[model samples]
Target: MATAPPPKSQHVGAAVAEKATSHVAQYSPDEKWAERSRKAMQDAITNPPADAYAGRSVKNTGNLAIAFRSLNEILVRNKVRQTVRMTERHEKKGTKRRRLQSERWRKQFSNEVRKKVQLVIKIRNRGA
Candidate 1:
């Protein structure tokens, strides 16, 4: 059997009305409410719209830092990948040959540190 939906109440009962009256009365002299209102007024005075800084000439400086970090990570990973590939290729030739190949890769990786430094300099110059 289907149950009928309960009808909505049309009346605001005396108890509910009394409670709401008390709440409004409490709000008048409430320190907490006054503090909240004060803070809200201060925020309205200070904060501009979210889009206020959207197209301004001011510098971000964050993007450049992120770019430099990402580039450094890519360069390091690529160096490692290439070294691994070369080492695998040399392994078929001989163990000593693989060791020599890895040493060459290590020397190549040493130069990558300079590239990371250059990237940082470029990022600092851009200021994003």
Candidate 2:
């Protein structure tokens, strides 16, 4: 006698599991950093402070240094605060060093944010 085919539910479940496994396998450290950097750049551009580049001519003085500093400070503070909140939510899970390291990473990430803002300023000035 011929054997019957597997159930439809089994096929669907296998396909779903394979898809989920493939997604997880496709993840890489580089992709993660790229996504994070893209997000930081977008955030920096979208929520620029009201006083960004204030009291200085972009063409002449090009107060990019001051603007970068201000933007970096804001970004770093926000990132650190977010990290702290997340750690608090997951309290008793991570070590103190892990928390400190996360804060340090957030601070370093702010430098990238500053660089992004500077690049935008340069492009805008060039276009003007």
Candidate 3:
């Protein structure tokens, strides 16, 4: 009698395993960075900046809008970064750090009409 062939699911599982292994080999360095980036991004998104950046907190929604607004801002920023990277010359590491630091400092609410609107809105309404 002839030997039986493996089941269909086993063949599919093996193919997935092989593909995952190949991707790992392709970018070994990205593995460690991926975890760190995920945690950092999660924290940053969870705790957003205050609404004082609007220059004045004339209308207070308790910062509930930051979580909503930041998502689109991040996407537009990503597109801007992609476009700038394609057009401009490569910038120095220090330049990138300085730019981010300046942004952080500028974003800090000044004494004038400073108010916070904490927005704790990330994945909402999980399955019942």
Candidate 4:
């Protein structure tokens, strides 16, 4: 039986979203979604939509900073994906489940440590 793929949810991470909280996204997604995401992210960084800077002047330093900041976010997202893929290799079916569970634990623990130091405050209230 064929399985339908999960719906894609776009997440735009801020500077400290990684430290503040773990992203509740799927791991080892379908090949098509992964390929599409990689392409979209690259296109986003290189060919941002016109309205992204509608009223802002590129000549202004702050406006430029915003652009750079967004660029950094894309880089960070790619970095996280790379970090996962860096260690990834073929595993026996039994071990694959354990490996993913460990990844979840690591992500959970990371947030706990950051929370201890009160870095959770860095997360912005978006679209408010």
Which candidate leads the pack in TM-score?
A: 4
> What C-alpha lDDT, on a 0 to 100 scale, does residue 40 get in candidate 2?
93
The ten-residue window of minimal lDDT in model 2 covers: 52-61
Candidate with more favorable, higher TM-score: 1 or 2: 2
Over the stretch 1-128, how does candidate 1's per-residue lDDT look in tens digits?
99775544534575577667886634455887888999999997787556733333234477887766666566575575576676675345577687778989998888797799899999999995
Q: Rate the local accuracy (lDDT) of all candidates.
A: 0.69, 0.75, 0.64, 0.67
> lDDT value for candidate 1?
0.69
What is the Å distance of residue 74 in model 3 from its true position? 8.7
lDDT of 3 by residue, 39-85 (tens): 99999898776763432233435785885576557657557557667
**Clash pairs, model 1 backbone:** none
Q: Which of the two candidates, 3 or 4, achieves a greater TM-score against the reference?
A: 4
| Model 4 TM-score, 2 decimals | 0.30
Task: Give every collision pair in model 2.
Answer: none
Candidate 1 positional error at 91, Å? 15
RMSD of each: 20.2, 22.2, 20.7, 24.8
What TM-score does model 3 achieve against the real structure?
0.23
Q: Write the per-residue lDDT of candidate 2 for residues 90-122, one digit (tens) a residue.
A: 555467678789979998999999999999999
Residue 50's lDDT within candidate 1 is: 67
